[model samples]
Target: MSRATVHFLLRSDLERLFTTLTDNQYEIIGPTVKDGAVLYTPIQHSEQLPQGWQQLQAPGAYRMTRDNSQRYFAWANGPQALKPWLFAPREIIWQAERQPDGSLQFSEPAQPDRKLAFIGLRNCDLAALKLQDQHFLQGQYRDPYYAARRKGLLLIAVNCSHPADTCFCASTGDGPHAKADSEQPGFDLCLTELDDGFLVQSGSEPGDQLLEQLPVSPTTENQLHQQLQQALQAAKQQRALPSLPIKDLLAERRDHPQWDDIAERCLACGNCTQVCPTCFCHAEGEQVSLNSAVSEHTREWASCFSEGHGYMAGHQARPGIRERYQQWMTHKLSYWHDQYGRSGCTGCGRCTTWCPAAIDFPLEVSRICGDDE
Candidate 1:
């Protein structure tokens, strides 16, 4: 669809959007303030959203403050992305039961049937979801659970007009502004928040239907120009990538000394992977009853920082924190390109913000790549 088809929604009618989704039986999940941070939570109405709230995020630090600017989503990105909602942290893949004849019966567990509509998804998160889809849905062995949850998934992407201090989505080419192409696997509806209203564009058929129900009018050319300018300004405020080619630089810097430096400050707490939108590493194990009568196979999110993650027959592949951290960085920045034809990271900066050790990835990349030059 052309940009001319885009519409403008008055700020007062925001609640109508929520009501429309609810009327369609779509559970709206959006950003809300909870426990001193903006978190993605279920919201029944627009009032539940974090209004006039802003978050200051840096390595090993996060502070939420009141903006009082009438902006509902002044915060860039939060601790959790779309990952936890789509790919559950802990899920039972299959279950087994003991029969009277002493034979075990195996059956797949029922998947969640809830219809989820993600509101306020940033452009980078939409890209991360696509990357995740390549692994879970497009792979040879499709995950039935993920497929079920993804079937009726709805995305309402919000363009990043206020990039965080730790954000580098502009450098990674994943965000700052949501993609406008209708053919892309992007948002159903993309919204650019202006001072008084939103410049909204629909990317899919369902989004068009929703837009038809909203109180909106055709967006003016001047409004579209201002929207583009705001996105450009946001991109300029984000952290920039290093001058060197990251994929090649990291691939060749396997033995860089900076890895050891990072390992020293690293707590191996797995907070980075936990908050990373694209990190999909997981481990599966079986839970058995006391009498071993029944066993349930379960899968949960795993971290490369975990010691046992790299365990083999008799030894750990990455016995040291240096090796483990190196493996994670390499896989995310370099090897992922080889496997998926794109970088795994969306540059949301959640990893740096949530890390207790305050490890900055952009600084690390510059250190390693710049040292070689």
Candidate 2:
């Protein structure tokens, strides 16, 4: 946690880091360009990382372009976050079988048997992971599946130096820079990629052990200063949220015309929730065998925009797109504060960048609250 413990890692040594993780039997999952978009995927070597590639993102727009710069993680974020790695999109909770005596037997599914070392995790996404932990791990009834996957998870957080057009972590206090401490429920190691090398700090005991195995030199004060400056510059470059209190603004503006305005532009396709790192809604169903002798209960990711999401016994509460949109926004911006003592959104801007409608929530908030400045 001390600045004295920070170290410098040369660009060439990145391969060594990956090798070390692989030697420790950790599956290395990091960012790579695939199918014209930056996505988190499995990587065996450091070369698999999307180096010198940057992304241009806007409302309803995303394009990958070459940056010519030697930076490895210049792009702020990709479509995937730490969510899927922890909370699987689809998982079988339990299965049941017909016994020999015509009785039913049920058992929980086996947990995944892999230790994951997640690389290129941004600070905002890291915060989202903690928020998810609050929901799945810290609840009265803990989610066994999520807990099992989270147990051996190692987070390697990257400090943001290149923010996207829609990013606003600066306003949400989630991040443009990773928190420089290990005591928090965040990354095991925090990395700041510089022109020539990376400024690395251990946030956990495993991170310290990994650092011990790597070829690294003590970081200089000048390098640390530059790291801080770059992070601050990234924060400055990101879009700023409205000056008004967001929770209060949304709470009082339930009847505001902005909901209707957004509904008009919103496709209700649920792309935002799907890409959002913090959205944890899911639906469970039981699948029966043809003979109805065996059944498997499975849970998969669900969206608030789904028409059935608001259905009751005989009626639907949010039958209209406007109500569905309102529910999504209000739950993210206002109700989440009451439930978790924090806003649900991390300001990572994935929703805006990937949305077909290009509906930027921060811009919408600014317009709704009349905070032009």
TM-scores, in order shown?
A: 0.96, 0.95
Q: Which candidate gets the maximum TM-score versus the true structure?
A: 1
Candidate 1 accuracy as TM-score? 0.96
RMSD of each: 1.6, 1.9
> 16, model 2: CA deviation in Å?
1.1
Candidate 1's residue-wise lDDT over 70-134, tens digit each? 98878888888799988999998888999999998999987789988999999999999999999
Q: List the lowest-lDDT window of 10 residues for candidate 2.
A: 364-373
**Residue 120 deviation, candidate 2, in Å?**
0.7
Candidate 2, which segments miss by more than 4 Å at Cα? 1-4, 371-373
User: In candidate 1, residue 74 scores what lDDT?
Assistant: 81
For candidate 1, the lDDT comes to: 0.88
The local distance difference test score of each candidate is 0.88, 0.88
